[model samples]
Target: MALDTGMKCIKYLLFIFNLLFVISGCVLIIVGAVIEANYRTYLDFISSSYLSAPSILIAVGVLIFVVGFFGCCGAVKENHCMVVTFVVLLFMIFIVQLGVGIASYILSNDVERFLHENMLKSMRNYDRSRPGVIKTWDVIQHDHACCGTNNYEDWTSTPYGEEYNGVPDACCKEHVSGCGRNIFNFSQKLNDINKEGCFDKLKGDVEENVTILGGIAIGIGFVQLIGIAFACCLAKSLKRQYETV
Candidate 1:
């Protein structure tokens, strides 16, 4: 009688786990579908600097849902075959995610390098004579230009032709040459450039997030596999008990 009671308890637990797994899986699937559908929109948002982080979260959410569903079904059926299948699926997902994350990191690094190199070249070739280019240069320079003032001398004190002490007039000249404008104007332009870059970075972050989500889904799937194993053991034990009775 005690053996029968234990079997009944084990069955009930398996049933509960299966139901929960199914529900979670469904939710994940829905979430993944939504994210997949809006992937372009999310990328656009990153491009616009409106949002950071994308696709990864959605992908992970989807995986979680699918794996959970499989786990639930396996538990309900007490089928070791399904449980093993789910485990294999999870392992594959994990491997794929690891590959993607590494690839993305490499790609982003390459892109950053390219952008930095090109921007440097563009700055060097910039035509200061062109009004638009000059204006743009001035905006960029003023914002990023840095100068240090000596404690012993006041920069504002040198009015008109008064010889400025400590600080070199060449400093201002360098700033003007680099940005093609005064610091104040350059600062504003720099801000605009930074805003655009921020958006691009956010998009990259979204892809990274997808990889992270995949890792997490893999973990959850692993746990579900353990649960399925436990369920199988319980089912076998119950069967043995019933046979003895």
Candidate 2:
């Protein structure tokens, strides 16, 4: 009777854990989607391959839902095979998530130079006629409160620089018609325009995103350990019960 009661408690705990898994799955999906959308906004500055982390997270979220179902059914029915399979799936996913989290953190350290190169390349190709380039640069400058890849002076060599003799109006501290005109004048430049580079600001943002992703992945992976242990205990109890019967 004591053993049966203990096994029953473990089964109920597993059921509860599975419910939490379902909720975590939903949260993971949302996190992945939000991050992916953010990255898309800066697609011109980032490699498409950088998207794989979020994509994997989204897939893992869906897989968690399936694994949760298996866990719930196995616990409810005391099905040994289902419970063992749940453990296997949970363990495999835990490893994958941990690996991705570590990899993301390591990659974050190296993204600065890559992003700088891309930022400069995109800046060189900037043209009003190219709406994509124009909009991206304008949005980046205005939103980040930054002027060029390195500094406001960096734009002085661009085609737009030749025409305007100053930074883009988006770089103006207090935007007004032609506020950026003649900003090369040291006093006016300091007073009217943002002097910082977009590269450092953007690099920090990207690194922060990846770091958050890493933290979430590793955190969830460790949390899944509890579920794995519960599944294993339940599977073993079920196996013993079957042998005795």
Candidate 3:
């Protein structure tokens, strides 16, 4: 009777974990699908460098969720072989989640650093009198000339282009209208604008996906630990059942 009770407890715990996993998994899948749908928008808003990998991470999250659902079912049935199979599959999912989380962290950090350094360098070389403030500005202008057409035209022609123009003034500093001009102020202003833009992109991406990713990571970690505990308890119960029989 005690052995049976123990087995029942394990089954209940497995059910609970499975339910939680399914719910979280479904949420993750939905979020991933949304991101995949608007991937181009994300790429255009944020750095495209991180887009491919994050999309893959989302796909993996969806797969783990589906696998987790099956594992839960297997555990609830009290089929020893099925239980073992579930455990093995859960372990694999945990491993993959860990790897993907780590990769995402590293990739995000690298991208952040690149943006920071590049923006600073561009700001340091900004010249108001020049065609564009810094390298990044030049790149943005070249790529998005039509996107910011009105602002670009104003910046290029007007005397107080740095002030009256719709473009962020920080990127468009005043250039002394003479020969042998010093552009230190112009460079500083450009860097500030680049920094602002970099931060904006980072914030936008985080707003879009950080919460969903974080929830999946936490949910998966919790499920894996609980699943392991339940598996151990189930194994002990099975051992007792065999001894009694």
lDDT of 3 by residue, 115-195 (tens): 554444433334444333433454554343221222333333333334333343333333222311222245543332322
Q: Can you write out model 1's per-residue Cα lDDT over 1-245, one digit (the tens) per residue?
A: 34356655665665576567557656665765665565434333112232233345556556656765665575556555565565566556656655665565556545555444443333333332433333433343334342221211222233211222222222243433333223233454333221222223333555566556555645654655555565556656645655787
Candidate 1 minimal-lDDT segment of 10 residues? 146-155
**With candidate 2 superimposed using the best TM-score fit, by how many Å does residue 114's alpha carbon deviate from the native?**
2.4
Pick the winner on TM-score between candidates 2 and 3. 2
Give the residue spans of candidate 1 off by over 4 A. 1-3, 44-215, 238-245
C-alpha lDDT of all candidate models, in order? 0.46, 0.83, 0.54
Per-residue accuracy of model 2 over 1-245 as CA lDDT, tens digit each: 12488788999999999988888888879999998887554544434465587887798789998898889999988788999989999999999989989999899878788888777777776775555577788888999899999998888888778777787889988888888877665574667788999988888887888899899889988988999998999888888878888
| Least well predicted 10-residue stretch by lDDT in candidate 3 | 175-184
The Cα error of candidate 3 at residue 33, in Å, is 1.0
lDDT of 3 at 231: 71
Arrange candidates by lDDT, highest first: which order? 2, 3, 1
Write the number of the candidate with greater lDDT, choosing between 2 and 3.
2
Candidate 3: regions farther than 4 A off: 1-3, 100-111, 117-223, 239-245
